[model samples]
Target: MESPKRTRNGADVTNAAMLVDHHCHLDFPQFAEDLDGIIGRAKAAGVGTMVTISTRIRQFDRIRVIAETYKDVYCSVGTHPHNADEELDIPVEDIIRLAQHPKCVAIGEAGLDYYYQHSSAQGQAEGFRRHIRAARETGLPLEIHARDADEDTATILADEHAQGAFPAVLHCFTGGRDLAMRAVDLGLYVSFSGVVSFKKSEALRALAAELPLDRILVETDAPYLAPVPYRGKTNEPAYVVHTAAAVAEARGITLTELAAATTENFFRLYTKAQPPEELDPSLLKGAPPQ
Candidate 1:
């Protein structure tokens, strides 16, 4: 059996301590250099593990290379709805086969994005259906990204859930409370990103506070949406610290308490991420080094 990791405050992972970045695109070109330093800083921030989400199934090999390169890193396997047209033929079998790799932890970063409409709404929806099916077939968590299409997203998820049960997560979740409650009802996890830290995101913060601890997760979604203080600068995995702090305050808890809770939530949802290498006592004591 795997040993549990100790958080920086000196708590075990099972007791609502330790933080995990459930969604991030670390494979983006923005981190081509100094990725090592990014990982190091993220670890120091109490973000012991991260998922470098895959936006294109065709490029999943490269993403897998990322997971293979680091102990704490893992990846997903699917195409973004924005790029649905590009990898339209990504077979479910191909995705399932590729996901067999131990490093591939989830099935997406995929879903609808009406806000951009980079791909036709139809193509996006079609791609979303395919990824959801993949999630059901592989028993891997679905990393859903919805923007300006809550109704459509919910409709699809509801339809798919009836087919069979599967683990799914709403990544970078900024939806209204209704969606949060619906996802929770559907046995899904909601992961907030740096956007949760924005001054204009009081509604989202309120939703975070309202959410049950077991269903809440936090992510950086890095190379974008860097939390405040680090806002306006290039976002990196390391900045997840600020995101966690914002989430902690939103939920009326200390950073260590928030970190521990979110971390436990991620592993509970993913069930594949191994524990962090060494337990940090400072994090458990809520006095992690600044």
Candidate 2:
């Protein structure tokens, strides 16, 4: 594997045809000690781009700084379902204004999480709708986080989308086939994470095989669900390759093919994010996987 080169300021400089970890939390304290090294290892593993997601609107500055520091990194802005109550007072205009940062490309990791229900269902729905409007207004993709609340998530998406179509993706999708198909039917993308690579995720893998190729995406949700080989360890962008490999195998395709397709899918949804100038075009042109 080729290691990433970096500048004195620690921005990744190496480029290759690689996969993208569409959702992660680089700003999390778990990466505080070795952030640069994590970026380097991800490059070595052929992950050329990463989007560190935001869990709280108030903490967006920390996430923004990480994106600004790493040339290949980008970020999103919004409150997670867990933090929805705390940021409920945050107006839609604030979310729009914050998303104007050059490195900020997506609108959220926002949606319903009945599984945890840290925030009231009403609070989560309100925040989700606000973020959806931000996405509709900003023309940036919304990174939705839904868990055990598929019905409500789908209902809100349908209701809000009926008002106006917006670019969005269901991040870390673990919902049933019905929700996945409904999301795709609504013209939204569905992203798979390390959870899809688990032994008990046979049903999830089957769904991955069934979803339309253009709407499928892969992520690590890292510093969280690490894939098989790194199952119990802290995940970083590097591990996205394993998730990609898993998705590719499940789809009966090569890693290079999966990399090309998902990376293309990523840029298509994240239109605000620009590819690194140093990126090797051949990677997207189907250069053999590392």
Candidate 3:
């Protein structure tokens, strides 16, 4: 379980196998100028598939366009807790309606975010419930973002799940062990982000390591939280390799094994983003030969 060496450019110099970012924000203005090049870089870095997450239902069109433009890209649709108030009128039916798109594979980057209280807690909770109902109705996975609101987040998920079961993943998980284990108890997946690679994140890494490998996934949450040695830089799908490596080492497994397990868990949860029986061999040819 030694750390995988990274080239200065962030490629896993030791591995050529593919990984999936599963979560990203390619539509953000940060990538507007070089989105294509960025996608190419991610491809070259062995990111075989990516889901550009939607943060606002009003911006679903923008998120969808990015997914539609990239063959390997898919997306989710829903409001972030910060903007939850803006789309409160939006009903479960509308969310399910929007999710019907072939490229929309999941729902809600939505959940409670007490840390940023940009929207009212009430608004966030209401929006979160609507998104949960939509996920349950649509049979699509729910992408959650719980920060400093773990108890409420867990309570809502459990309360709703009791009404009916729905697939979900605690995207970019930074919750307590109680919340994480509860999510696992409810048949949800827990995804780790670049934060797990931080030197101060030993506790997080240990918690991530202890989770069931089959119930765990990995992501970038780009363009944010770039893992070290790219710390202080804009994060992207290509940097997911760093987080993946950290997770693999924490789990006492090789990077290649973690890649296979996380990618499988991703598809099993997202369900709609089916990997081809055979990936294009050309995708294995990463980053334009550097």
Q: How should the candidates be ordered by TM-score, best one leading? A: 3, 2, 1
- TM-score each candidate: 0.89, 0.92, 0.92
Candidate 1 Cα outliers beyond 4 Å, as residue runs: 1-17, 280-290
- Which 10 successive residues of model 2 have the least lDDT summed? 7-16
Indicate the TM-score of model 3.
Answer: 0.92
The lDDT leader among the candidates is 2
lDDT of 1 at 142: 92
Tens digit of lDDT per residue, candidate 3, span 64-113?
99999988899999999999999998877889999999999999899999
Clashing pairs in 3: 44-286, 44-287
What is the lDDT, from 0 to 100, of the residue 226 in candidate 3? 88
Q: Residue 206 of model 1: what lDDT? A: 91
Residue pairs in steric clash, candidate 2?
17-283
Q: What is the C-alpha local distance difference test score of candidate 1? A: 0.80
Q: Model 3, 88: alpha-carbon shift in Å? A: 0.3
After superposition, which runs of candidate 3 have C-alpha atoms over 4 Å from their true positions?
Answer: 1-16, 276-290
Segments in model 2 whose C-alpha atoms lie over 4 Å from true places: 1-17, 278-290
